[model samples]
Target: MAGSFHGLTVFNNNVHAQNSDSLSQADIAEPLFDIEKETYIGTILQNAANPTFRFDPRKGKSPSAFFAEVDPTPSAPGINEMVKPPTFPNVSPVAPDGLIVSSPGFHFNEQNNAMSAFQNALVPPKPNITISNSETDDGYNVFSKAGCIKCHAGSYFTNHQIIPADKIGTEPSRAKALAKTAKIFAEPLLYSPTENVPIRKNARVLKIPLNNIDEQQLRLGFAHDGKGGYKTPSLIGLYWQAPYLHDGGVAVGYEHNYGLTGTLLKGKPVDPYRSIIALVDRKERQKVIKANASLHSVHITGDGHSFWVDQESGFTKKEQIALAKYLLSLNKGRTEQQ
Candidate 1:
């Protein structure tokens, strides 16, 4: 028996021992098999400890004890399972500072109200110019006269309804337009009437003055005055639309020319009456020039002549700041849904 015990101990040494102190009886009950002897020492020990050690021949041996095992039942998920859903890309909740003209005053807390009042006072309202054309009551007519509606028409401030001029009525056209325009595929554009359009009250909140201005007075000239100039963009939610201009040139300041080339404005020097140049002081003028110079120039062939525009031409610092405020007012949950 001693010799048998020695041989069994030697053979069983090859099998890994569980920490007896840490492991429960259930963990060690399944014995590792001795291939040479064709017997399970761990199981023998378990049966020896019990008087009812009936080796039921009907019961088959367990799977290889050497193999690692995994629990078949799924474990509990981590805390991330409880998190909120992701927001739509590029679209964000309105910042407290981003109040628009059309936004409800009730949304403002006392602190927000104080900040808005300070911003309003700092940026005094510009003189509201008379608009002659009678299209729609709210400055949609001004937008049209300025040629904004050709591209920006519709409730969402974009003509998702219009196919791009280049690829009209084709899959490629829809794809290209979707890529360039934000309103395409955007939740606000698809479901909300005013999603693309910024709230007007938020514009007021941003303190952007939106009175009608004379269209002719704002045209571009030889320095790249209004030749291919797009209509002035709508102020609806202007806060969100940064890096302004159709070509995305001027972001925080205004320029007198839309093209980058000095040549565009060289011959036609912007008519002061029709340009941002007329409103700013010498210091402000320098700021506009600096901002315009920072942008890249675009060249296109026209009327047998090569012309360039700065692309940053129409935005001024004052206008940019005010426009941002006006845009903020166009947040969701402000108006009662129709």
Candidate 2:
């Protein structure tokens, strides 16, 4: 959408925006919005609120400010950055709300409540006849003892940190997607007119904070020039979400046809339980990777984070199953107690 808007403005017409329909030929095989079960929309907003990109000052302003800048005519890059067409309409620019704002789709306040009450609502299901307490314990033990806790920490099961594509060894395409973002407009133009009079006045700019960041980590986490880092995700209700990883390639659901993509208009259904097993077991993960690579985009590989829990890792088959059961048992709030 940002691409469409930028093409429209920079080219001084709606030709590129109209041409987008011609560009989208493939069927939508993207992951469902019923995501990792911890309010990812909120996480994105928080990331945007941060000043620097991936903790690097060289990255210029954060995504929130960059997209919010409604000034179509930017001077720093020079008005002659592109050839202005004769049909260019002299109209007030629309704020890039669709890029950052949620439409009237989901009810939760994605900008403010991702890590709070909205996240709390994404709990796991209750224990069933097949699941036992001992299984959950074994799973938790395997997760902790295997050193997974170092990164996937806290009640949300994530440290809320961004790691470089190299360190985690995932598909790097999406990480590098925004590497060359231009600072088209300054921060003063970001405030929407909807804000209160005192706060909504034009030309009001607050300097975003740029201190107290882990520079070394930032260096490792993104390009030295400041781009491309994947945020560690929270593992809240692992049972409900299918097609794990930043890319939704590590998916399952087609067999029983019950998972996220099962809705009539969406892609084929997958089994969340089976897909997760594939996530933990390296051999199984390879099969998923192969499948994802065959049909999905380059960014949608199920590879990386090869921390396995199978026999090769010296775990017995029973223990592996136990760990899977324990993972499936994860839930929050009253549902956990039940």
What CA root-mean-square deviation does each model show from the true structure?
Answer: 28.7, 15.0
Per-residue lDDT of 105-223 in model 2, one digit per residue for the tens?
32212232233334344446663426766666787788887777888887667886777777777777767643332122112122231333223224333332224446554443334
Off by over 4 Å in 2: 1-130, 182-194, 197-203, 216-227, 254-267, 296-298, 333-338
* Count of backbone clashes, every candidate in sequence: 46, 8
Segments of candidate 1 deviating more than 4 angstroms: 1-138, 161-236, 253-290, 297-338
**lDDT (CA) per prediction:** 0.26, 0.47
Rate residue 170 of model 1 by lDDT: 13
**Candidate 1, poorest ten consecutive residues by summed lDDT:** 76-85
TM-score of each: 0.22, 0.56
Tens digits of per-residue lDDT for model 1 on 131-192? 22331233332334334456555554554232222222111211231121222111111111
